[model samples]
Every structure is written in C-alpha cells, then in structure tokens.
Target chain A: QQQVKQSPQSLIVQKGGIPIINCAYENTAFDYFPWYQQFPGKGPALLIAIRPDVSEKKEGRFTISFNKSAKQFSLHIMDSQPGDSATYFCAARSGTGNQFYFGTGTSLTVIP
Target chain B: NAGVTQTPKFRILKIGQSMTLQCTQDMNHNYMYWYRQDPGMGLKLIYYSVGAGITDKGEVPNGYNVSRSTTEDFPLRLELAAPSQTSVYFCASSYGNSYEQYFGPGTRLTVT
Candidate 1:
C-alpha cells in the first residue's frame, strides 16, 4: 500500500518565487512529517519537519503547512533560488513504529 | 562530527557477485536504516536496526541482509548482485526515532 503520496512529479519556479510541494498520507497513526532535499548523486537530507499538533512551522526560507484532519501536508520554499533546485521527498512516521513511509518525490528546478 | 559515513561511494558488480555496503555513524544513534532509491521512485527500506544485534526487514528486503554489530556500524550485504538491485543506497541514523534522521552521502551501485 502506498501510505504516502506526493504530487507534481516535477516543478519549475522562477528565482525569488515561492514553490510548493504537497503530500498526503493514509495512515492515521503517523504523527511526524518530514521533508527531505536531495541533490544529484547524494543522499536525501532532512530539510524541515512538523508534528500533527501544529498547523504550520517555518524555518528560514522553508515552511511546512500541515493539516491533521485532512491527512495532508506541504513544503513551501520562499524566494526559491538556483541552489534550491533538487529533488524533494515527503515522509511520515508513526509515533510508535520503527518504519517510515516516503512519497514518490518531486524534482524542483529554479530558473535563474 | 561526521554524522554518517558510507564507504565505496560508487561500485560496479557483475551478476552473482557478492559484496557488503558499510555504514557507520558518529552520532551513536540507536536507530539505523538501509534504503535504496530507484530513478523517479521514493526510497524503499531494505532493512533496519533498532540497536546492536536487533534487525528487521522493511518494505523491500529481498536479497539483502543486514547486521548491526555495534551502534556505530550497520552493514548491508548483497549475496547475489542482480540488475534489479542497481540503485543508489543510503544509510540513515536517528537518535530515538522521532523527527530527524541523519543520512550518509550514499553509495551508487550498478549490477551488470
């Protein structure tokens, strides 16, 4: 079962614009949602994360908007830059489980 | 702090060959995971370990084995290389499995 689903397999945005990537999960037990950024030939790294308790969380130029009732969440990149061009993955983990579910991924390209 | 490190950044193997991908973390995390990523696909977990000597399978665990002999070392073994196994492998560690998962660079494997 695809526990987590992500939209927009690829995206393109202009520099200084905001680009958003969304994801949804089916498992209700999941409480932790995290976003990862990956560059070519590199492993994905944690970008930002949020729990089900909060509606939104922002760090620097990145923000995560989450809705517990809808089982959906999104990652927004503010003032997108060329350096932000890469693949982004959304993942969810249950509070008590050792497993984590990951979304397919979204490739973002920021135009200079 | 050399959060996580993987050896043999890239490798090419022939069918039926066997090799082990080594992963080590300096963070002394208790949770470790091995995941594989295919083109345009989200990462699939192969194996995971909660602590030394405790291992479990993940979503796609076929033809792969793992051992957590120590908190710092988690090695993934491939008994017989196959074309289907050609993908990028990543190692990740988490302190207590909450939100953050630190990842190693990655190992690119090609089987012919």
Candidate 2:
C-alpha cells in the first residue's frame, strides 16, 4: 500500500506560469510535510516544508498549502521558470515515528 | 559541509552478483535512510537508522540490508542482484525524526 499518493505523473507549463502539484495521505499521524526537487542525475533537494498546524507556508516562489483535516497538501510554484523544471516529490513524516512516506513524484517541465 | 555523499554514481551487476552502496554525511545527523526510486513509481524507503546500532525496516526491505556503525556512515548491501532491483538509490540524513532531511546524489544500479 502506498502511504502517500500524488497525482499527475508529469506536468508541463510555460515560463511565468504557476504549476501546482498535489499529494494526499491517509495517515492522520503525519505532522510534517516536505517537498523536494531533483534535477537529472542529482539527488533531491529540500524545496519547502510545512507543519499541519499551519494552513500554509511560503518561501520565495515556492509555497506549500496544507489541509490537516483533509489529509492533503499541495505545492505551488509562482512565476515558474525554466529552471524550475525538475522532478518534485512530496513526503510525510509521522509525529510518533522516524519513518517518512514519499509520494510517487511529479515531473514538471517549464517551457520557455 | 558536503552534506551527504554516496559512492559510485552508477553500477552494473549480473544476476546473483552482490554489491554494497556507501553513504556518508558530514553533518553528524543521527537519522539516516535508504530509498529506491523506480520509473514513474516514486521513491520507496528500504531501510533507515535512528542512530548508530539502531536500524529498522521501512516500506520496502526485501533483498536489501543496511548498517549504521557511526553517526556519519550508513551502508546498504545487496546480497544478490535481480532485475527488480534495477533502480536509482538515494541516501538521506536528518537531525531528528521529523527534521529536514539532506539527500545524497543517488546511485543508479542496473541488474541483468
């Protein structure tokens, strides 16, 4: 069973457009949600994160919108650029455990 | 600080072959994890360690083994290679159970 599920295996957007990637989880125990970005042949890097206590968190052009009750979270990239083209993964960590569950990932392509 | 480092960016193995994937972190993190990413399937946790000498299995642990003898090093071993194990492997480390994780450049392994 996949603990975390993500939609849209791939996405394409033009420069300056907004790209949204969504994820859902069934475990209510998950309290921390994070998004990672990976380029070809490189490791995934932390892009942004959010705590379920807050409805949303934003850093620069990246923002995370979290709904605790809905058990869902989404990442939105504002003014998306060609450089933002990469694979994005959403992960959740339980408050009571050390293991993290990751989503299948969404490959976003920004066209110039 | 080099964050995290993984050895042998790529490898190829024949059926029944064995190999060890090395992971090291200079951040002195106590939590470490190993994950495998397959095409369009996302990333799955294979094994994780909370601290030295304390290891646990994650979502996918079959055919894979891990050991953490020190705060900075975690190694994953494959006793026998199989086609199903052909995927990109990643190592990650964090300060605590729910803290931000740092990931290493993945190791791409192929089995014939």
Worst 10 residues of 2 chain A by lDDT: A93-102
Tens-place lDDT per residue, model 1, B1-112, is 9889999899999999999999999997999999999877798889989999999999999999999889999999999999999999999999987578888999999999
- What DockQ, between 0 and 1, does each candidate earn? 0.74, 0.77
lDDT (Cα, tens digit) per residue for candidate 2, span A1-112: 8899998799999999999999999988887898999999988888988888999999999999988888889999999999999999999987765888889999999999
**Deviating ranges (above 4 Å) for candidate 1:** none
Clashing pairs for model 2 are none
Displacement of residue A60 (Cα, Å) in model 1 is 1.4
Deviation of model 2 at A30, angstroms:
0.5
DockQ category of candidate 2: medium
Give the Cα RMSD of candidate 1: 1.1
RMSD of 2: 1.0
